[model samples]
Target chain A: MSGAFISFQDATKDYGSVRVVENLNLDIARGEFVSLLGPSGSGKTTLLMMLAGFESVSGGTITLDGKVINDLPTYKRDMGVVFQNYALFPHMTVARNVAFPLEMRGEAKAVTAAKVKKALDMVQLGQLADRLPGQLSGGQQQRVALARALVFEPRVVLMDEPLGALDKQLREQMQLDIRELHHRLGLTVIFVTHDQDEALTMSDRIAIFNHGKIQQCAAPREVYDHPANRFVAEFIGETNLLDCKVSENAGETFSVTLDDGSVVAAHGLPGLVAGDRALLSLRPERIEILPAETDATATGQNRLAGEILDTIYQGDHLRVVIETAVGQIIARTDRKAQEWPVRARVMLTFRAADGWVIAP
Target chain B: MMAMSLFKSVYATLIVGFLVAPLLVVLPLAFTSGAFLTYPIPSYSFRWFSELVENTVWSRAILNSLLIAGSTTVVATLLGTLAALGLRARNLVLSSQIRTLFLLPMVVPAVVLGVGMQALFVRFGINSTYLSVIVAHSVIAIPFVVISVSGALGGIDRRVERAAESLGARPHKVFFLVTLPLAMPGVASGAALAFATSLDEVVLTLFVAGPNQRTLARQMFSTLRENISPAIASAAFVIIVGTILVALLLLLMRRRSA
Candidate 1:
């Protein structure tokens, strides 16, 4: 990723009495694929629209390549946009749709033709160029829209759930295709989506927003493995939140006592007393299950224990639901393991490094 | 279920027939050989149709009506489409209110508008002229154009316009190349309505038109007052058929575009 090519300085948008987005600040590097990930009404799409110049910045400046673009009209910004519905020009053929931006810029006829052909070839929709948008399938129309956006070779591209209208299979395929296109072109992309998996799969960096503010922004794995806060952890993926009280304070690690009178070591925070309440996030797949007679004693650095209440046989893994002394917990195991039946006595254990103490 | 649907279908047919009965009565009467405008014709002939084409006064009125209606259609469509574009956004309360005010000519009784325009045109000393009639017709027709074009604009996904803008189209270029082309069907329908309104207009034209500026409807009105001529029925039939053809053309255009 290059240095900051687009910056939002305290951007705000208010729709009369309701504030859709409030005081948002972000710096997007050139050639970086950033996904604004959030649930509905989280203002992710609103922020994207503001960057695309569709919506105005009510109280802040949006600088593109270090120049203020707050007063520039959307057309003058020289950006490309792909909409969720694909927004292909219904009146024009696919080739014509792809040629529209070049036509707008008054490009030479021969150059526009070559660029349109190259764009269509990039999306693998070259044969459908003569068809009207209505005559093609949904996925084909989306490719035409993509081709139209890319033909101009704009520096930045904004996508608002571009694959939202496709089915699961096509959506996944398009995600990989778009990601590859971004890698090849080295064009900056700001994608908006509510799907965590999609964001994790495509983005170089993910910004998780809530209540019109970014809760955390980092690499995809960083966000998933080392979330900055409780909201970020819960929003990224499933986690078992357990309540604990601090029992010992080391230099950087804290010894916390779980509800079941078990002591576990977690790495976070300073200035924590022995009696301070904290929340621990435990990943399901990180927990390992041992045979009943084998692990009454703590093995290596494992502490938790539970009896298997049920086992769900997924094709690739087994989901084991356990009833522990503290609470009900879930553990994911490989399907190759010996089948654990209902009501089997089991010892569930996980590394202290896998669980982190999050401030409540 | 079938019996109930049959009864509903019959009821709807009766209502449609009742609405169309007046127009049906005038259509065949245009071909009646007798001088009187009675139904149950004694014989049929083309005498009234020939009279309609030969009469200089009625022909001139028809020509004037066509010219005025054509001009009204062009003016109303351009202004109405522009208004639709200007007022399509969720904001712009004042512009929307002003748009509602433009619809006043459609909702208000034509007599009231005619009286008001008569006063205004008199003050300007242009009352009862072709200019006065064309202006009045435009006022009446603009609301229809506005309504149709607005409907078309509403049906379009506004994101497409934004996409066009992001693709480097200036505001005016976006409107002309992208927005106007998408909304052309609505503009066409609106223009059709405007032309029909101006062509068939009688009450306002009677109040505002000079003798030389009399439209086909006004000419038909005067002919009825003097002596009931089959030529009046011929003119009515022509106007009705012309309106239907224009309306059908609009529907066909919509379907083809779809």
Candidate 2:
């Protein structure tokens, strides 16, 4: 990225003797919405806290707009942080809570009132300005928190699992709302969440974290369609990781032999060589199941003959488990397609480009 | 279940009677028309209550008690709130031990504390002054403030403070605007308790106060040693009613805030 807006250079964090984040190096271009997606204890939230100035960097520098601000106090960082619990002042009315930052900056009373009204209107909570936070619903309080964070117009906004407390429908609605705000206001945002769907739906790039390190960082489609490693493959969505040994390593493609002596062609990670052990990551949704007697074939497609072990009827799709020569492979097919009974023979086919090889 | 409930009701009545029996005996004496505190044939009147306000000695004692208790509330609340805030530090070594140290005056015998405070105040050449009395009273009153304020401070979500800081409020502003307002109910209740403690205090007052600084409780003690007057009963009546009123006010404040 040229002229990065915020960068963490070899940043490390330790709590007592336990290192939570180790030598993290990442940069965000201006107005980019990046998400740190990981499971619990993966240090995603820790990285966000460090950038918010709530936690200190144990080593290396975190520079913002070309200025190293490792030691700057949270109040001077000029960043808005929205906590999962909303963290609104319980005693203050919604209007007063939104007006607090302006008051702290010693803005004139009339100006503060006008700005507070504008913020409340933005969140569509202007009618509830006089209500205390305790009187509002969970979603309403979240909107108030969002309004307050944006009222200061900070250069960057950091949200730590902001939608973790909401129901599914409300959470999706908030995701779209936050994404729209990020675009309309041109706000630089760093969101931390464990939900891959949320990260994919909102962020320009998703940084997959595990065991205190980022495994991969890329655009949503790139990460999902071509995961960098097994962790990213399984964590982002459902996938079948097949054990394979490299039989041939061409420049752009490689042929691997599965455990049952079935040869499968797939894209390799450049480091693969012939006879090396590698895992093949195949998405369940990418495979198509055809009738046993059909002579349908396509270019660049890998095929395997198998019997239908089980068929699970999902609402929109059918999940068919096949006992193939490679292993037990699971494929998702459209629900409207022809149904295959258990014990019936079927052919599974997927493009070689869809299967990615990762080092074992 | 019926038998258990009957037993519980009887046990409660016994406890209530045991506590109120003494007040009932002493309060009716405040309405006695007779000069001496005794039973039977004494017509009811407000004569002693009138004498409480009219007599200069009793009036001055009331004034002194109010002045000392008021000042003690201010000093105790300030010091106690600060101590509670300091103890809120994470990973504080021997935290419970430090809290125990703050509460030592609550359990230590009042006579022992009075003796030590008298010697300390005399060494500082401030004995027998209103400042000495207020300071001595605050020593015992501070523990209540600490207990209440620390409990309130504990209930707060620390992230709320961080949110304020992230919004560009400095540490001091975060405390004053966010923390202090939220913990105000505790501070208020603590102040009321401190005032009550000072008003009821006698042993400590006797050790540190002079004739000019005589308080109502101290005057009641001295008057008991000299002679039993209806004025003493009236003073006790005033104190019991005042304490209950203060307690009610504290409860009402907590309810409204909650």
Candidate 3:
């Protein structure tokens, strides 16, 4: 958090009796791309809106460049914003739309024209600059929106679900395009989206939000591997959450007894104690099917006896659902790997280090 | 299916024919060689058309109508566009209530409104002045402006204004550069509609206007009561032409904007 360029110090928002965004304290480094990932009504978009000055912070301050900018109007905030709907001015051509910000700032006409051309060129939309927004496809309109926001040379860019309206392929391409732009310009960006895959794909760091709170904020791999709590673990990827009490707790590892009287040893994630009720988060990809006797004789890996209920062939992998003694568990494996039919009796094995324990 | 569509087109043509039958009957009579209103063996002439321009009463009524309708258009367009903007303002309380109030004239009985306005104007001692006629016409005309402009505003994405604001344009700049240009089609149509509404208004003019402010509609009403002159037919022709021009303008603006 040191040498942070943009910081939200205990910022909060309220709508009469409902407090949508609680005290949110986050520091985004200069030239960093951070995404706020959450479900609908999770206040991720609200936080981005607050930063862009579209919404006011109910308490505390949002500082940019070591100065508080909480009360600055949107026009004076000097931050670029790409809305979810693109929100292009329908009457203006693409070029005029990009030039609007420069005109607003009273920049010289020559400089404005040069910069507009450059921005449109950056988006590869220079050829279509004369077309109105309605004439462009969804992806083209999005690029125009991006160009307009970037043409002003704002220090920070905020995007609120900018790709939500696009098809999957176009969305992915835009994600990469935005990522490349961020890298090329070294621009600080705060992206908001409900899609976990999108956040993981585009963000250098992600803040997982739920109920107006940041449950976890870390690098993609860090959050995936060692989620801060059950919500983070479940929200970020597919995982089988096993409800079990802590049978034993050491500094780095623990053991838990499943409801079916099965004892499973597991590594811990910094905050579990003996006799505490904890849920063991086992990722689907981390579990592998094994022969029953080999799993029983295994020394260190955690094991579960199950009967395969179904095997779904996803494009790249197979999602196998199994009914174990405790409950249902989902395991995702390579589609070309060893086959498991329905009613297949198998033992599931996962390394103890892969089993994460979270209390509540 | 083709036959059914043919039947539908024929039905539509019949309805349109019924609607234009009066115009078809009167327009040719304006150029009638004979003095009678009947259409048996009448040849075509421009005598009535010339009479319409030559007669002082008819010419003065046309001038008065133009003046009043033009003023009503300006006043109604301004008031209605302003009211529409106010309705769109954030944090405005009872916005729909205000909108309903603006649209009330469209639904209220014309005679009732004329009577009420006549009483009010008389109390103010401006009962039969040009101001009274212009005000009454503008009041009814405002609803057209409001509806058209509001429809234009509705098609606009509100976020576009916010986008403008975010891009360093202030509120006024957003309104002028973003909201205003986007809603131009609606405003143009609203102005044209308001002008047409004022031109055709007769009941309110009769109640509030004096002889000096007698519009073409008032003149036509009185002439119909006395004798069905071909001069009235020529006046109707002028009105039809004016309305067609305005309607054409509205259509052109819509297509251009679209």
Candidate 4:
């Protein structure tokens, strides 16, 4: 976000008349871990392919180190890319797979072997160097792919859903390993994934993409704390969106009136105006539900009176959905409240700051 | 269902026997001491095999067959592999039609192809040269190479090539270092098939090749009218054994590659 390393200047991609990626502009800083997070068909993978020189840029320029690379072939790009399927060569052993890039670069034989060994050791796959790619497990294959991509010490590494084929536990472990690698090596990584948790955990900044455009790009905490719009808020995590109309817009404070005539203060976007229809997005875990006897409905706090619709057990937390006069509001609380059940009367309470105002 | 399965088993066994019976009968007959292809062997002897090596005409015919078949294997493999690679292009115009045209030699009757090639080679004044027979056999062998190589190419995962390019390999290097190695099994099998097709070809050579360049198959066909020699049986034995060896080599290659 501060210093640009890899920048897309109005980059676009199209297939015939269908535009897969619109005019996109983003700056990836040096030594930063940036992720393109989106659903399938959102053009995130297309953008990565364009950067890797596999797809031609339809309308704009892509630059690395201040040099335009529009017509450069993939081999001349000098950037490493790990595919979603791992794509390990079935005919080659792990060591040869790692050495392929170095050999292509015409490195000395001794240097290539040493660097390959170091890279494999970095990924803890040193023992499997002599094994062919087909003989290794899925996780090991993924590690070999990583080793090959990193063996040449390229300036930037692009990974396209590299952990998508692994199981849940293995995926998370690989995510942490990648994050640690990024931290230790300080190499810029542009990761593309559909999983939100992966982006939140492994990225310094994440660009939330939808409809071939970026809705927001910021740090994980910044995106989680203040999403740019409804798409950003909903795509990043679970949230309860309530319809409301802006009632007051004073300095540093904006208030919105709920559909049921309940008014609450919210921190709206900078462009919000009085009397505009908007949504109050509140994270489920941010809202607290209490029994009818609690005396917590006070000023500076948004309050709602509703009956519990149903209670769901989520292993460590109890998710209670309340049917209020306006709409349903969900609250996730500690599982110790086992007594909360169906059709129980409850009071929903949240701070004014927890409700983020977003225009439709 | 049980009775139907039993019937299917018997039917399949009978078909296999029908196909394999002639091939087996030729081998034992080739070893017979008699001068004809009669049923029971009077005594097993190497007289025909000895005569096969000493006879000048038969030895020359064997050399011609080996030379033509070797050349045919080389020419067909290169051209057919190139055709298969070209067909992988997505933008090739009327590619399906082109693929069928490439395989037309396999569908057309051998006699028709032979007559057509005979006329064309005569018009070009290449009818009597060794080139005519080699090219004619190549026409028939190319389809097998194309079919086999294309099968191998199709089985390969295209993402592996993309991976190689991403690893900084140029297009040609990607083909040599990744694609060709993965498709070697198909290419080798195709070569074996082309060689076998060339060895067994008769009508095409008979129509195109002259008397001096007479191939083993053509000479063997003439032996029926000129003389009933068991040397033909010896040549048949040699061809059968050679083909089986090549097939076994192909199987071993596929297993090793896999």
Clashing residue pairs found in predicted model 4: none
TM-score of each: 0.95, 0.95, 0.96, 0.96
Model 1, range B195-254, lDDT digits (tens) per residue? 998998888887788988989999998899999888999999889888999989988998
Worst lDDT run of 10 residues, candidate 1 chain A, spans A295-304
Candidate 3 segments whose C-alpha is farther than 4 A from its true place: A1-3, A295-299, B1-7
Candidate number that wins on DockQ, 3 or 4: 3
How large an RMSD does model 1 have?
A: 2.1
Strongest candidate by lDDT: 2
Error of 2 at A12 (Å): 0.7
Residues B138-234, model 2: lDDT tens digits: 9999999999999899989999999999999999999998899889898988899899999999999999999999999999999988988989999
For model 3, residues A279-320, the per-residue Cα lDDT tens digits are 998999999898666737755678899999999999999999
Which 10-residue span in candidate 4 chain B carries the lowest summed lDDT? Answer: B23-32
Residue B128 local lDDT, model 2: 99
Each prediction's DockQ against the real complex? 0.82, 0.81, 0.80, 0.80
- TM-score: model 3, chain A: 0.96
Comparison by lDDT, 2 against 3, better one: 2
Chain A of candidate 1 gets a TM-score of 0.95
Better of 2 and 3 by TM-score: 3
Residue pairs in candidate 2 whose N, alpha carbon or C atoms collide under 3 angstroms: none
lDDT of 2 by residue, A214-332 (tens): 99999999899878888999999898899999999898888999898888889868888998999999899999888776675543478788999999999999998999877899989
What DockQ was computed for model 3?
0.80
